[model samples]
Target: DAGVTQSPTHLIKTRGQQVTLRCSPKSGHDTVSWYQQALGQGPQFIFQYYEEEERQRGNFPDRFSGHQFPNYSSELNVNALLLGDSALYLCASSFGTAVQYFGPGTRLTVT
Candidate 1:
């Protein structure tokens, strides 16, 4: 019955560094999606994981990756980070195409 939760409410890293953010989905959920939101901009879908497989992806490059566990938890990993990568990383959980519950989001700052 828990809601979506994301770890490391905030993070700071220099360009070229790598970062990993974690997320735990709400109970009875089987899908997890990741997104990036820049200041003054709407979120851009990164990808979605279900049944431990990536089902869909956005226009982002290969540097953005994610994984979903059997228990429905997920992790997002970004490599070769760029300053432009700084933004809010949000995780959303839902069952099928039903309405999703989003996490508070992890603010990532790239220097």
Candidate 2:
């Protein structure tokens, strides 16, 4: 039972640059969602993917985009990143409406 995994446990990026984060959903799960968590803040849903298409999205801008592969893995790409983009990018997965299991996350530090 492999849980969700993310790369580069930590990262540093400059303002205005772009960054891509990857994720592998937990075994037995078919949906993936991305979230951003800032210091002392709760996770904010960016978007969710099901059937290899975006099923739902939050208040983020177009700069925040994602993709889900047939294998159930996903990736989040942020363009024109800003200093505020510095946060923990979490990947969550679920089988249905059930609770989602989260990964350790890739910390993006925008300077």
Candidate 3:
């Protein structure tokens, strides 16, 4: 079976622009988490979605949001983007706190 997959592996946006990143979880996974990774640093948890509702969030501002679909796919939406938002956005799918399967992350650049 295939692992997690993401769309638009690379993305470019300007400050104040909004972007949406999509992720299709591995088969049978129902929960999804989003993370942001800056250069030279590990991934920072953004938020998690399960049962179509947000279950947890990290230190990110309200500009970051997510949704989990009934089918278990998820989306990460960032509003009022800033240059500081430039980073690799990752999508991880798992089963209720189980080992997460991560996708090849979307690299976003904000100018």
Off by over 4 Å in 1: none
For residues 1-111, write the lDDT of model 1, one tens digit per residue.
Answer: 679999999999999999999999998899999999999999999999989999999999999999999998999999999999999999999997688889999999999
Clashing pairs in 2: none
Tens-place lDDT per residue, model 2, 19-105, is 999999899999999999999999999999999999999999999999999999998999999999999999999997679999999
Error of 3 at 39 (Å): 0.5
Model 2 earns a TM-score of 0.97
| TM match of model 1 to true structure | 0.97
lDDT of 3: 0.94
Whole-model lDDT, model 1: 0.95
Per-prediction TM-score:
0.97, 0.97, 0.98
In model 3, pairs of residues that clash are none
- In candidate 1, where is summed lDDT lowest over 10 consecutive residues? 93-102
User: Residue by residue across 1-111, what tens digits does model 3's lDDT show?
Assistant: 999999889999999999999999999899999999999999999999989999999999999988888899999999999999999999999998899989999999999
Model 3 misplacement above 4 A: none
